[model samples]
Target chain A: MEWLYVLMPIAGVKIFWPGLIILGVGVGIIGGFFGMGGAWMVTPGLNILGFPMAFAIGTDIAHMAGKSLISTMRHGKFGNVDYKLGMIMLIGTVVGFEIGAQMIMWLERLGSVEKVVRYLYVVLLALIAWMVFHDINVKKKKEAKMVAAGGDAKDAVGVEWHKTFHAIKIPPMMHFNEAGIYCSMWLPVFVSFLTGWLAGILGIGGGLIRMPSLIYIVGCPTHVAVGTDLFEVAISGVYGAGTYTYKGRTELVAAVIMLVGASMGAQVGAVATKYIKGYGIRYAFGLAVIGCIVSIVLKLVAKAQNIPILDDASTAVVLATVSSLSLYILLRFIAGCKKELAEIAAKG
Target chain B: MKTRFIKLFSWCLFACLALPEFAHAAAAKVSNIVIVADTRKFSGWEAWWTNLYNESHLYFALLTMALIPTVGVIFGTFADFLMGFIGIDLKSRGDVGH
Candidate 1:
């Protein structure tokens, strides 16, 4: 147990090595599965594990860059990434984030905007959760109807947003072969800009918002969205890591150890997505949103009441929720692997 | 087509590297965030790394940025091998649209 502890000289703290590895594993699975950096999930986990608050974000981003690369490779092999679309979105994201940051600065001069920002964060999480759940419900009902009509449930095209997306013929239209989307070039650009603005306002990695936008708005399949978003995260994570390291905050040693766990976890998570339908990923992701909302509410209440224990409790709740969710995903991955292997054996 | 992609990739890479610096420079004036640690207190490998970091922040940052993803890829390749040993093909399993 004593040997499990490692000293981070830069952060001037000693952390339980295994705890960091476990945290990385959990986040790796979620990040790989959802195609987001899962920074919100990692911050609280690090806090609970007694990691220095100063180094927490830097370390998380550092590991995230590496973790996402692994996930992206796995997803790429599955033909889940759309590099062309991701690149187009990157251009829009940069411009949008700049504008959003400027708007925040203006608001800050008017008054203290911390409370407002936190409230907005909560509302955004709630709205996203509701939307995802609603989409999944609609999908399930559509599939059931198809079954009742003596049609193949697997053939049911649940949502039809893509029809509208594809209908807009603003030139020059672009085709993303990997994502199987052919639409106006402006579509991905506009969606990315919008999501990037939200991310700038919310001070998050934007992966959460971008992943959804890629699906519902840009007309990408769910799995492609996840992989493409991971590609984006990998690039953004590197930039984030660079800045934090330049500020002398990243703990490279800890990040390295985390990468060890993330490597395996990412494979499991990405493979699991292949087993499940698009809506299944959406359902799981929606649950994660609820978990985030609860955590944010706890933090807000803790801040309002000036209760230290409540803050700690909030961290605990997040850690518990994420740990459970990651475990469930891992279990599903194991089951999916076994089933796929059996199918292959049958074919043989 | 390959050359065009390479050119596009280089520009994107440039933008990715530059935006953070622009954001940080602007953020420095308005944001209350500050680095908390003192480099003087660091010793051993920490001191060495810290000194190098301070001397050339950009270089150190780039190095770190490269190191992380490289490490991740190595780990990923290792995992692929281990999974292969167990008869699971990560590359080809359930591959769909490309």
Candidate 2:
């Protein structure tokens, strides 16, 4: 009975399992398609659901670690992973995580860590949302122009700046068979360092940055980029978790439970991505960023106003956003599968 | 141009390494509670040993957590590939119109 009492709060409302399911589904789909764990969504969702912020962060990282392992393994089998590039990035990632953890410790001393982090989350979310939305819109307009000209829409986006970066001859050049590029090894290391720096500073996986950088700058095929990014995320996530644990800020039980949910969710999400197309992924990614922005806004408002009611409202908004995204991903997966089956029938 | 690019890359790497040292210095001042509870209060060696053990455990925990991400990435990459081979090609599914 005493054990049950201890378990009760951990279980916290019966909705936790459902929440876990929804979180897993959403993250899995996004992660599969984008090669991101969607930790930004996971951490806040857990916090809103009555887990302490530190616990939420720790658990999110832990779950991410487990989920990434599953996803990376799946992706690797497809010949998509660039091990040399991932290893180069790993070096930078570790250094960035240690520094980021130190910054959080400094903030904690001021006793305004929560406020500062929330503010930063809001600002970052807004910025990321804007970038994703802008890119999606630009891509759409470009596709429309291609359609009008009766050309393949994919060619209109052109080679991004990062790909051009690969053409720059630099010393210590490296080749990535999966990426199909021979560029200075330093490029990936530099990108990883920057992404790691951001992840450490923000207390989030830098997958949001990593995925795009791999695709545009690193010139990785979109699928391979997704796989490699997950590899990067897993590496960085572990480092971040270790830093937090060293500070005695990690909640192990919570992290383990979340891991159970996320690992399973990741499998489904990774599988789902096989059916969804590139543009669909881009649009969904845009929507996810927008969802994050809204949730962050709600959290910021609740914190600023000292309104307990606002907290509930923020939680509701987050839950709703996660639910909608999860549904969209699942539906997209089903639709893709159906289309594939229909094609097979037509061929038959 | 090659030399210049190498210089820039090295510069970036050095900057990354330097930033963490500054952050760690700031972190050093923050006092963290070290839990070393025992069923009975003891003196001298037993107490010292207990403290040492607790500290080691904490370090172990940190190491375990940090390893998770790297391992995850390796695994996630493989998972992505497997899915791709299974005829999913997720990023291209929406392009059936072509």
Candidate 3:
């Protein structure tokens, strides 16, 4: 294990190469399947592997750009990416993120805003988790009612908020053909702005927030949201990686090693999305949110108590949970792929 | 619950907009984290890279930025080949009609 460590040139640190690859695979599966960057999952893993915090963020973003491109390619093949919608959302995201970053800088002038930001982060995660679970329950209830009324379960209506959004005829409406939506163009723009603002305030890549926003607010199907979000992430990740690298904060060697594992994991995760329904993905995403909440809570507790061991313990817990979840996702992806191929063979 | 969540989310956003001052008043840095590593010094390519980073910062930075995504594309293409071998299609999902 000691001999497996490699030196990071820019960050001037030694990291376990295998640990970085394993961490990449775990995050890759989650990112590919959910269409989010999964930054929260990667940070602790990097920290535990003795990667420098100064470099961790830049290195993570560098790999994320590559990993997301892989996911976007696969999801695009599956008709999961909405490029037109993504472009529109990107406009809003940039402006909103700039404003949000400025706001944070302003707040920092008065005093350190770290705790408030962390609390806000946890709150956001909780809200997202609740929303995903609620959507799942609503779908379940609707399906049950439809079956009871002698209609097919598949006939149950989907989320109604999009209809309300469409009804708001404030301005020019646009059709996102790939996402199967025709609503006020302002809808996606507004939703992306809000998510991006939150992302900026939290200083995180906005995939987790944006994915849910795409699904629930913009009325994108879950699969489309994942793909579109990955598309957005890819672009933003490149910008992030570039800026951080310019600051000499990136460890390119680590990023490259991670990308190798991430590419494979991205394929598995993206392909798995084809076999899972929208609600199924939402349910899994909700669970991942809960896992994140648990990890954050542990870190908060550790900090409040000034216990270093507790902090390490929290990191260990997150690593374990993420590892298991990624493993489960991989297994599911494999099974789903095999099943789909067999069905195709039988039909042929 | 869904309606309540929407309401809460809206309120949270509003709070973020309105209360920038009040939120940071009770701010204390709760965690003091450090990244520890051995400085064994650098030689060979590592030494040259460090010198380049210090001497021509912008060029070194540009090189890293370009190299990362290029590597990503190469790996992505490799994954595409592997997926195709496993009977997976990367061209399209045939969902155009939808």
Instruction: Give the candidate number with the greatest DockQ.
Output: 1
Q: What is the lDDT of candidate 1?
A: 0.81
The CAPRI class of candidate 1 is acceptable
Model 3, docking class: incorrect
Candidate 1 Cα errors over 4 Å, as ranges? B1-6, B9-47, B54-56, B93-98
Clashing pairs in 3: none
From the highest TM-score down, the ranking of the candidates is: 1, 3, 2
Each candidate: RMSD to true structure?
Answer: 2.6, 7.4, 8.3
What lDDT tens digits, residue by residue, belong to model 1 across residues B1-94? 9999999899878786757643563353333454444477777887887667667667767878889988899987787787778778676546
A150 in model 1: Cα distance from truth in Å?
2.0
Ranking by DockQ: 1, 3, 2
lDDT of 2 at A277: 51
User: lDDT winner among the candidates?
Assistant: 1
The per-residue C-alpha lDDT of model 1 at residue B97 equals 24
lDDT for each residue of candidate 3 in A1-348, tens digit (9 for 90 to 100): 678988776677778898888888888888999998888888888888888687787788889988998788888878899998997897788767767777887899999898899999999999999888887778779999988889888745445677777889777888899899999989998998898788778877889899988888888878899999999998777766766665566677888999988877887788777767677778888988888888788888888889888787778777877888788888887787687678878988
Candidate 2 local lDDT, A1-348, one digit each (tens): 232222212222223555554565566656656788677667657765566554465557666766777777666755657877787777776676666767676677767576676677667656655655666677778889889989988655533556679787778998898777889988887777777766666766678767766766677766677778888776555554665555554545455545555665565565566666545565676677676667667767877888877767766766676677777776766676677768867887
Tens digits of per-residue lDDT for model 1, A45-121 = 88777788877888888999998988898999888999999988987887777677777777889999979998998
Worst 10 residues of 3 chain A by lDDT: A154-163
